[model samples]
Target: MLNLSSHHLQTIQAHAESTYPEECCGLLLGHLSSDTKMLIEVLPTENSWDGEMVDVLQVVDDSSEGKFSKRNRFSIAPQVMLKAQKNARDRNLNIIGIYHSHTDHPAIPSEFDRAIAWMEYSYIIVSVRQGSACDLKSWTLDDNHQFQPEEILTVSL
Candidate 1:
């Protein structure tokens, strides 16, 4: 099971709403050192498939254009991945989880999400509807690359 605060969920939703058509994605960087719990930091980042570590980039689209290119692809930018990795390393934190928003679908993990997910980490999905946020769910990849529902608990920040 994964544990996260409502505030963190809100932040992710806001990002999704802000991104609109294209899809908003990021990394949940922090540590759950003890079995009990720990605070998870929400680091908003761009989608980059260049490398393993995702780096965080500055928000450039402040305007409400809501325009998604024809590609309709979502991923963390290479630079963003690098930055996120550095940030995690400096804080001695592991890549405990990942976050992404579904523009028209529910918070459940889609088939593609399940296919591309890294089995070692938790996947957080936020669903946005008509520019409004609706639901949130987390999933874990099982042995067969299938999505297994996971529980989210509140964490102290």
Candidate 2:
């Protein structure tokens, strides 16, 4: 299970709504225990996905909007990740998970997301439709590297 504060969920939803048409990405800074991850901060990041340039993700956009491209993919810079790690360490926190938005798509893990996941972290996805943020879901990888839905428990901030 993933434990996040009400404020944290709001921040994530807002970020998703703000970045509609393009997926928003961020880091989940928190404490990780044996059975749950308690979030302490939501660190939003810029999506610098300039990879391949094939616009292959366009096919993944099932909506008739068909406005897919690099916007459909998100990449958090390695430098930002390194910095976040150091910052989290300074605060006695760990990057327990990552969060991203899927425009016009369900709040479920995509093939690309599953392929790049780490078993140690949770993945939160928010579905944003036409600029409105909708469903939200969390996923974690099992021993086989396949995504399994995780429960999200909200607590008071």
Candidate 3:
């Protein structure tokens, strides 16, 4: 189970809502701090060289009325990914995982998600429906490209 405090969860929700109509994406960087638990410490670094170029992700736009549809979606600009990595290095925080929002799907990894997942790290998924975040889930890809649930422990501010 991904153990996130209400605060962390709310932050994710806010980010998702803020990016409604598009799949909002970011990285969760922190440390394990133990053998079996992940401690998320921050949201995507806007000023971090490694994360600066990552574009805010979004899914298909709703044709009926300029909005997000109930489709599985996610995106991350390559520049942002590189900047996020650099930001992690500068902060001495190892990127234990990443995060992205699904416009109308469950907070579960989709087939595309699995295909791109990397082991040794976690992927956080937030589900948003009509501009509201409904759920959050976490997964880790194995050698066979299968997703497995992972535990999380968001640290206090």
Cα lDDT computed for each candidate against the true fold: 0.69, 0.86, 0.64
Judging by TM-score against the true structure, name the best candidate: 2
- How many clashes in each structure? 17, 0, 11
Ranking by lDDT: 2, 1, 3
| Candidate 1 per-residue lDDT over residues 84-146, each given as its tens digit | 889888988777777888877788875556656786678888888887778888887778888
lDDT of 1: 0.69
After TM-score superposition, the amount by which residue 79's alpha carbon in candidate 3 deviates from its true location, in angstroms, is 2.0
TM-score of 3: 0.72
Model 2: C-alpha RMSD to truth?
3.8
Per-residue alpha-carbon lDDT of model 3 for 1-157, expressed as tens digits? Answer: 3445667777767887887756676677765554443445546423221222222222212233322222444555567778778987897777777777887778888766776567777788888898888888888876677898776666454
Q: lDDT per residue, candidate 2, 17-110, as tens digits?
A: 9888899999999999988999999999987677443354445443534333545778788899999999999999999999999989899898
In Å, residue 157's CA in model 1 sits off its true spot by: 2.6
TM-score of each: 0.76, 0.89, 0.72
